[model samples]
Structure formats: structure tokens, C-alpha cells
Target: MIAAFLLLLQAVAPPGVATQVAPAAPSAAMPTASVPLPPQDWSGLPILPIRRSATIQANTSMYVHGEVMAGRCAKAVRTAQGWTLTLDLAVLATPQGRFRRVTPRAIDCPTVEQYAAGVLVGTPRDAIDLDDTQTDTWYRTSMTFTWAGS
Candidate 1:
């Protein structure tokens, strides 16, 4: 379990690290007009289906990335609760890939807590099974969102 969690943490490594999906670029076939016209309908376009695992990983990565890039997590100190706004998240699953519910736990920082909760709740997620029953898996981790130096 610890090994799995560690691997998950590595999935959200800092920028310059390689990931499976390459950054999207404008296709050569696309028009080079100064003002691009908006598509009237998206039904003709190909829809890329992403796995739940991938979605979860991407969300985690973006959460960390946004905080760091915005300088919201500078000069954080390690506390008994692990420095960051450590949250225990329970992401419920549904067919629409939307989270039926989300609950936060082990939150110590009120500001970070409110922000994280607003972001996580009602998000897309996959259902995890425990034993014979299906349930949501709780992901717990610490994260810093303080800008002390600035």
C-alpha cells in the first residue's frame, strides 16, 4: 500500500518531468487565419476517452502544479500534520465519471481546507472496491499552499 501511494506521489512530479500524454499542439491542417472561427458543433470531432486512473492522476498533478506555479506553497514548514494542507479525500464514483460525493478529512489549515474542498467535491472519479463491497477509496496526503517569502 505504501509503495502504491509513493508511486502515485511520483505521478505528480515537478515540471520538466515526462508524462505519457504529449502536450497538444495545433494541427498543421488547421487554418492559419488571424481569427479562427469557433466550431458550430463538436459532434464531428473525435472524443478521446480517458481512464479514471488517468483522470485522478492528472487532477492530482494539476493541483500540485497550480499551487507551486502560483507561489502558493513557498516556505512551508513541516508540522506534525506534514507541512501541507494534508487532506483525506473520499471520491465517490458514478457512471457519468462524476463523483457522487466527496468528503475531506484530516485537514488542519482552514484556508487550504476550504479551497481544496471546493475543488474536489463533485469532481469525476472512479469507484474503488474493498473486500466484497464497492466503495470509494480515500487518498490522504499533505500539501503546502502558503506563500511566506512573498
Candidate 2:
């Protein structure tokens, strides 16, 4: 079931985009028995889907397009054909799949980092499947965004 879910997520992701997941540091106070075992293959987790929001999409599109058109990211080799940005996010959620926070690791481009964080923040709480056995733990996930040159 997890395999299927991951495949479905990859199928829906745009070209050049990828997702990976990892367990965050466990709290020292938390009982070992209570802490769920982390998945061996962290990269196999499904990518969280962004919520349907025209405003967010439009804003992201405009920002990325503007940056590409202006050649703001052209210096990077990844921008030769276009621009590619990878964002690493630390996500905290409840067992019920409610998102508590989505924090992005800083990148060279502050604006892009901010946008990536916003995208995660805009994702639906239940987008990620959290079983009853899950606890309130942080998960590390990465998302890559690519845009073709005009």
C-alpha cells in the first residue's frame, strides 16, 4: 500500500520533481516502545500533495516565471535549460495527520525558500497518510521544483 501511494505521488509530480522522507530526532523523554520504528527506505514515502489553491499557484507561477525571465537564477548551471530548486522541509504532524508546522531549510535564494515553505504550508493536513500507530514526530522531506526557460 505504501509502495502504491508513493508511485501515485510520483506520477502526479511534475517532471524533475522528487520527494524523500526521513524520521526526525526522537525525544529523549519519549519511551522507546512508544516511538515508532522509522522506515528503512526514507525516500520511498509519498510526496505530500499541495492543496488546490489558484491564488497560491498563480503567485508561485508568477514569481518563478519572473525570476526565469529576468535571468535571476541563470548563474546556476541548473538554470541553463531552466531553473531547479530543491527544498528540504522539516514537517511536524499529529497521528490524525494534522500538520503542526512545515519549516524549510534555507537555500541560496531566500525568496525561493520562502515560496517552498509556503507551498508546504498550503498542503492539506491529511495529504500525508498517518496511521494510528504514528506519534507526533517530525519528518524530513525534500521537494524539487524545475522550470523550463522561456
The residue-by-residue lDDT of candidate 1 on 1-150, one tens digit each, is: 324433543465333322111112467986533222223443343222323432344455355445545666443354554333344433333333333333334334333443444444322333222222253222322233432222
Q: Whole-model Cα lDDT per candidate?
A: 0.36, 0.52
* Backbone atom clashes (below 3 Å) for every candidate: 3, 0
Model 2 spans with C-alpha error above 4 angstroms: 1-62, 65-81
Q: Give the winner by TM-score.
A: 2
What tens digits encode model 2's per-residue C-alpha lDDT throughout 1-150? 334544554465433332322224558885433334434454554444443432345455556556546655442235577666566766655666655555566556545555565566545443555556455656667666666654
- Alpha carbon lDDT of residue 47, candidate 1? 26
